[model samples]
Target: MKTTVRRDVLTLPVAPTGPENPLPPLRPPGDPHTPDERAKNGLPRDMARQVGYEPLRSLLPVRLLDGYGRKRTDTPLGTLVIENGRLRATVLPGYGGRVHSLLHKPTGRELLYRNPVLQPAGFALNGAWFSGGIEWNIGATGHTTLSCAPVHAARVTAPDGGEMLRLWEWERLRDLPFQVDLWLPEDSDFLHVGVRIRNPHEKPAPVYWWSNMAVPEERRVLAPADEAWRFAHPGGLRRVPVPVSDGADRTYPPRSEYSADYFFDVPDGARRWIAALDEDGHGLVQTSTDLPRGRKLFVWGTGSGGRRWQEWLTEPGTGGYAEIQSGLARTQLEHVRLDAGTEFSWLESYGPLSARADLVHGDWADACAETRARLADALPGEAVDAAYVAWLARADTEPGEVLAVGSGWGALEVLRAEYKLPGTPFDESTLGTEQAPWLELLRSGAFPEPCEVAPPGPTLVSRNWRDMLETAPARPLTEYHLGVAQWHEGDRAQAVRSWERGLERALSRWPLLRCLAVADAVEGHLERAADRYAEAFDDLCQERRDDGAAWTAATAALGREAISGLLAADRPEAARAVWDRLHETTRAEGRFRLVEAQIRYAEGDIAAVRAVFDEGFEAADLREGAEPLGDLWAAATGGEEIPARYDFRLRP
Candidate 1:
């Protein structure tokens, strides 16, 4: 057992900050508590470092979860590497306490698809979620809002005379508490995993938890369930049979054209275990202790979208992998309702399993037998020895010294001493030197020249800036910026044209579609705006329709945007239709009520607008944030000024 604090990392500024620690950890005025209560890139005031929160739904799709909000001058980060007779485990203290890697020493196998880089792609909702290793999902799934912030980590001796890495955090999303204890029994092969979560609120909250494990692709996924359900990307559930879906056994990998992401439910009156076996006999099994658990598999398909996501998540070689996820109860869609302050806990054990070929297609009985055999083989001889060296993004810069490095899996690579590298010490530059300048500008919070778009106002922005740039940038981002700039310059007619072109390149970007719809409305293309807003709203609803309480807030904001977009274009009937559809799920939501009031005010129905404010919203309502709503209510009654821009801002 060893702990390391890289002094060099201390010199790395522009990260976490704390109060009374040189850096002010300045939060916006009057906006103190953010999602995760917003831990800036700083160490916890106490030894038990707490993870930060993020917005339930972030407006900006930037990766702020990486402690970028924290000032580097505030706190120190460290890593812990623990090893025993046969297995080695590594945990990153600063980065969400995620288990970086688990190595089976005898076979020299990196048990997990250990990512060699800390490169974060703008994929996850709150951003800063990476591939490989294991990740913890609390609150509203999709890689927790605190996926990158530090969690409380402690090195404690297990009751069974083994080393335990105890990590815990107060997940702010639902005001719930979570704790994960990783125990490696002395001379044992498995890592005993224990998890406990408690809802602190007086009332019940919809709690979601998923332990996402990234393993090699094409691994045989074995579960006790006979029937599996494919979870659709937007947010729906369709039942699919085990080992096959549309003429393909998703469990066997080599994914479909797009992406194969779905949950495998444990059949009633079945055993509780999910295992994955690679072609090389070495396997990993996650077994629970009669707890309500479910399994999931995600294989990024072979299509352009799939390939692009693969490249985005990792530096090649560490490319293809599937996430063997374990959920608390059921799918992310139908999440379990955790009673207020009711402490829920479970224990799961994971270890190496090299079973016979015959057991590959067998049921739970045979799988358990093989797993037991593997565990028996894992127990060491009389002499039990422990202690090994592993690095936590620590690299010693020296030529050919046989560094026991890697992202804590194997000696992947090493940074020459004092060599400061971007990404992580484990990462090699994959986007190449050509993309370096573009990436640098993006990181510096600046648009890469062509992406310079001013806000919509009397001010004339750089319209069609891509055409003016000397380099002739070919990226979809170029068009996205061009469209924004054109729209800001009051050229909505041209902005719609540019955004449509941009959407062709960045097809998955929903925000672009939303912006395009707004531009269409501004250009008096009411029919186009109505149609586009409907599509955008559908897309948004698909992804977030079932994220529990989070959905309520998200849909409130989304409904307001959709309905307002339609109303702005003078398509009152179309706006009503959108409102009815949203009412199916987000019925009588406060934000929509605000939008309804605004619509009536726009229609010269002052009484209706006043009546809405008279029916006051609760403090917990999502519409409470826009304090200006009250003033808008007053204006409708008191004959005060009502600016049309307020509709676009949705500030009401």
Candidate 2:
């Protein structure tokens, strides 16, 4: 009985069920989003019920793909990990593919509250809903049609060459396909979450998404609002403002000891972010652009009812978790109507927030200042253009120096080295500082307000480059196919030119960096290729895009050839950097340790390279199980002929 030393990539592919994949003629009808009421949602009347984990029927485990692509007799455990040194996520594929736990490694504590047990509670919008972790609620007005349904899960690469855990489930209520891609970019302190909700119906379909984050109990919520409104369930709505004594201000550790459930559509806040902090200055920040249209805070307080509900929701002693949830339209009560064949996608970011000062006021202003200051330190010299500030403040960090430190593209050495980046100073970083008057014209970003336009209804999906580029000049989705078509045609040079044209017209840096990366790799410019990969990745970290599924996957996998070229050029350090970001950015499957050993070998570690011959044969990821490395090293040392390696070839 021997335990496997896992040094290879692991793949557990869960196949598609079915749908009329309408666009492609020679494609599988395996997409679940059909034109009929095939997948419907509702728990009818389940208010009086007890729900917990059953034997998990209907889904049987299959053999898993090991590092060497060999079939193992073991059944898949239904969990996948996508880590980017800064953030780590444990995906629960078995349980609706929600993030079971999210961790910020810099701080040993778990950013998400982890459950010791896997019991479902009856206190959900549908039949049952599990508490804790980050849940992507999509579909019906309730806790989402897929809130409790098992979702298909896979590892994916993001367009900017970052690694991601992709999870999708068909909305049972409205025959729609929804996916959430969780990205962990290297060195960047935030976790980027990209979501795409597709309406496959012939008529306009009602769809919505809410990213729910559950932190520990006893936390304050900072949802800055001059006026807050919640649906009165039957009749009218109420208007509540901040610092109200009536306990309507659901900020930080709730003011009321009783259960306080607050939900509002598009709160009046300058920034699209909500925060929750524990006693210890440590907290988690949830930020987005226009993806979320509402903010919600749920609290059961420390009362008897709260304790009882907690015990009912979780297993005994497991405790409970509060939610700082976001909505796509109005509140969860309002649905964004999407036309047939239309898809809406947006980027959301989550980062570990540890502030030196305590912002107990729970105002939006305080939340904005703290998060802006902290992230500005984590990512220095980034063109910080945010709203709420009358003007933009100048950055003390030199653009050239920050860009030279790789601008946090891919795996940043500065982050690994543990350095304090410059913060938005009071002198010139804030709106009311000395530079406040001229900040608006001086800032480089589009100062966006809390996009009040109704989704689909009042404001439908704007697929045009002109409108899309107004907010996102980093990755233009409107003309992405021009480059993708050329890339698929196997003419990468033309693809690069097309992307260049796209950049000139759209000002998207992602296509340009990726185009440069492929060209550099083809021209044997491994260093530039590596840099381009990181730069493209950095561009994405700053701003990511997922217009279509194929385009997004292609964007992430484009750097594969560059990584191979770097390794062939004997630039293992650069190769390793790409691999680090790749693992965090995409579901790139290949041998990573060989490149690691090559890195060690290049760094003057002969003993480590020599050890490959002894223990490396058992390694599953090797193309020939250590034979290729052995022969290559032998050729270099004993003057023997080098073997032909297909992976190292540079071709069209």
268-288: candidate 1 lDDT, tens digit per residue: 555456677876556777665
Highest lDDT against the true fold, candidate: 1
Instruction: Name the regions of candidate 1 deviating beyond 4 angstroms.
Output: 1-77, 361-652
lDDT of 2 by residue, 109-213 (tens): 788777654444333333335567888877544454344455554444443444445555445335455556565656666666666776644578766567888
The number of clashing residue pairs in each candidate reads 20, 19
CA lDDT for candidate 1: 0.53
* Model 1 clashes, total count: 20
Find the 10 residues in a row with the least total lDDT in model 2.
401-410
Point out the worst 10-residue segment of candidate 1 by lDDT.
17-26
- Report how far off residue 490 is in candidate 2 (Å): 52
Q: Give the best candidate by TM-score.
A: 1
